[model samples]
Target: MPAATFEPPAHRGLLTESIARRLQNEIRSGAIPVGAKLPSERELAVQFGASRNVLREVLRRLEAQHLIEVAPGRGSFVIDQSTADARSYDALYRAGRPTVRQLIEARIPIEVEIVGLATSRATDVQIEAMRTANAAMIAATDPVVKARADLEFHDTIAAAAGNPVLRIMLSSIGGMMFEMMLRSNSDPSIAEPGVPHHPEILEAITARDTDRARHHMREHLSLALRTYGPDLDLSLDVMAANHIETLLHRRSTP
Candidate 1:
């Protein structure tokens, strides 16, 4: 591996962001080999002319992007890149800043396929995990928790894909999509309380019936599209926030 070099960003107001970008550039350029241990926070702070707090924040940001992992009593290490993994995929997702519609469109193809794959690949343990996630979703009363469980359930299917790369891609999109859905659908009460498709999807996968898995996936997505979808009428609140009210107000005046 090469000695890591820092690439300056266009702007550098925050020390943490600057540090993160520099580190990210180094990783992408192969200066820092995957799975390499990073310098200590104190050393990094001294090297970057930043405080320990600043360096730690920078590390946190990278960890969130899955570029690095910090272990307690151990140290921060660059995530291994050898196997097809979620790190780069997660970093790409974080870099894109996707919107609700973009996320949904991205999810459709991957999710539809994941179900079919799960039917073939799912093990008994994985099936039990999916059931646990389903139960969590049902037990959740808050939108955020429900959204998380919903994402986890989908992730379970992707994990069953038995392909690390595919699973990474699925999880990257699923994590961000979860947050986006929660934010966009601020009202938890708009649709039904919990995930409605989990049981059907689970049953299909458990039975090893690919057609049934695909059918259930389609049915679920169709319902999701109709419910929390990005259509103009998804919610009055979204409309109000987006100035549809002002447009309607103008139309009525004319």
Candidate 2:
């Protein structure tokens, strides 16, 4: 079968998401059969009337969803639709009730691997971005601002790793991570000690030392787990109750 073509949307809002959704429909419908090679990035960009960067981001999202596999030198290829559907459903289910312990446990190895990747792959520009984010995190006084900065700081590191799938995976639990940060930052004692490690992790990434980068990333997340993990149990209970209430209300509605 010939490769599918996409028409650009009329509005600009959520362009990347729109493009991803279109491509996802095609893949799921077998218009782009499993094991088939997708059109080149250049071709897809022109077909969608989007910039190459936008096309690339959309492709990354599809890759994250397991709909496509992007080879380094070759083009992208469609994956098994049933397998992709299962993975997507699993990710959605997990995102609905992610626990603090589960987030922390998942972050340890993932962040460690990304930090290592950033050490080798991150550009000077990306490193500078991380530095700026870390500085903002250190200087922010409000708990909410600090928590936002904290997530952005780690997100910068993830971006530097240049793997959108890993970044997306981390982002799936970002809400829980943000809640954990807010709870920790609300307490001066817990937040103060953890502040210094952000720069240490950034410095290790700066030096291109994979081992040290992994070590500092692990140390930072481990400290967070030790300090806030206990309090999170209560928070999770509250969240679970809220979720149940929301579900019940929806069920009771006409």
Model 1 earns a TM-score of: 0.54
Instruction: Encode model 2's per-residue lDDT on 1-254: one tens digit a residue.
Output: 12233323322223454466567757776788999998888898778776776788888878987878889898899887555454574345343555666667878989999899989999999999998888887787655567778899889999999999999987776755765676566566577788778888888888898999899889888875676645444544344334333433443357
Per-candidate clash tally: 0, 0
Instruction: Using TM-score, give the best candidate's number.
Output: 2
The per-residue C-alpha lDDT of model 1 at residue 87 equals 51
Flag clash pairs in model 1: none
Error of 2 at 73 (Å): 51
TM values, all candidates: 0.54, 0.56
Q: Model 1, stretches more than 4 Å misplaced? A: 1-63, 66-91, 94-97, 181-190, 229-254
Error of 1 at 116 (Å): 0.6
RMSD of each: 12.5, 12.4
Reference-based lDDT, residue 33, model 1: 83
